[model samples]
Target: MTRVLVTGAKGQLGSDLKELSVHLQNIKFTFIDIDELDITSTEAISDFFSGQVFDYLINSAAYTAVDKAESDKETAFQVNAEAINSLISVIRKSQTKFIHISTDYVFSGDHNIPYTEDFQVNPQSTYGKSKLKGEEYVLQYENGMIIRTAWLYSSYGQNFVKSILKKGREKEELKVVNDQLGSPTYSGHLAKAILDIINKDMDNSIPFKPEIFHFTNAGVCSWFDFALKIKELAYLPCRILPVSTEQYPLPAKRPAYSVLSKEKIISKYKINIPDWKTGLKDCLGKLGELR
Candidate 1:
């Protein structure tokens, strides 16, 4: 069995990965949250990895508080950048296949076209810069895969979709930014992709080449459109008004156009990515079940 070490075990993506792992009998997963293993402490992580033999390290641990990262830059860098370097150090010694999860925030969103894997990155926020630093570390090793996703949400965590559902049910009206454009990635879908990568490698279905790839739901839309869909699907009688970025200011400046190109991942892995609308509906259905 392929042993996999999954960090951030309690996170939405990690939780989904764990839930999906039940079906993959050939893979053994060791899930660890920050509480169980402090990622920022190099000594702690180093000691933990020294005793275990893992074939793959799925690093989902990150500092994702976008606006809060502005004030807590130290913590953000420690978890997202410094800790990543520390983890890579241990993984290098263990000869583990590192799979680092990254974000679309690494771009400045100044382009009108979709961001390709080769696009020059220009992070505009502290969080983005820190994540970019982590990605840099992963690339320096040159033996792992880096997957960058955007607008991630799932039933297990606090996210835009959940926030919309909560507020839409509470308040009668809400204003969302229509200028910002990107793809929404459901954590469950991403988890499946991760497992599929491992399965493909085991079966020799596709030649495993470690490189940066973008994975998001197939289509793109503005935040306003996403919110409207959420409201509609959740059966919330909320009025969603379309607004500009300038109208609703945030501490962290978001990408105006950060839709990632999936051509690379799609062709390479031959994985069929669901559309944003379809993913959203499925997510809402899952949420409904929890309620």
Candidate 2:
């Protein structure tokens, strides 16, 4: 049986992957989080992987607090950068493949056009910088897929989608930024796509062009547009007021146009990405189950 180990087992993406584990065939899974596994501790990871032989390591662990990351860069680096390096050191020796989840924030987002794989990275946020380092660590291993996704959310964990639904119920109006652009990547959808890549065993012997590819549901919108759709779907009695980035400032800067092109990932994997709006509606229908 193929053994697949997923870090950040309790996160939005990890939780969704756990839910789907029931239907996966010929796989024994080990899902670990900070509690079960302290990835920051090199000794801990060295000891853990030393005894186990996992076919794949799906790394979902990260320091996701955008504003907090500005001040807590050390913590972010420990988890996002060092932790990844630790795992890569061990996994590089094994035949196991890696599927590292990354963010679109790694790019500068200055371009109004969709960001292709070859696009240069000039991250403006601490979170983005840390994640980029993690990407580099994963890329060191030739047999790995550093899947870069943006604006991720699911019917699980603390996420923008759930946060909006929660606040929308309490507030009469919500202010959202209209400047930043990206796609909403439902965690379940992204997880499924990654698993498909492993299951199909896509050959990378052919020199893959821009090994780093963008993944988001079809179509794109600004944060303001996303909030509006969420309110509409949930039927929340709240007015989503669109505003500029200046209206809502944070400690960490965000990409003004971080939209990424999915043409490569789609053509390679043939993934059928649903629109974020469609994903939101379905996820909202199960919001009660999320908590």
* TM-scores for every candidate against the unseen true structure: 0.97, 0.94
lDDT of 2 by residue, 73-164 (tens): 99998998889888988888885788888998899988999988878988899999999999888778776778889999988898889888
Please give, for residues 133-218, the per-residue lDDT of candidate 1 as tens digits.
Answer: 99999998856889999999997989999999889889989999999999998999999998888788778887456799999998
TM accuracy, model 1: 0.97
lDDT scores for all predictions?
A: 0.90, 0.85
**What is the C-alpha RMSD, rounded to one decimal, of candidate 2?**
2.5
The 10-residue segment of model 2 with minimum total lDDT is: 201-210
Candidate 2: regions farther than 4 A off: 202-210, 288-291
Error of 2 at 161 (Å): 1.2
The top-ranked prediction according to TM-score is 1
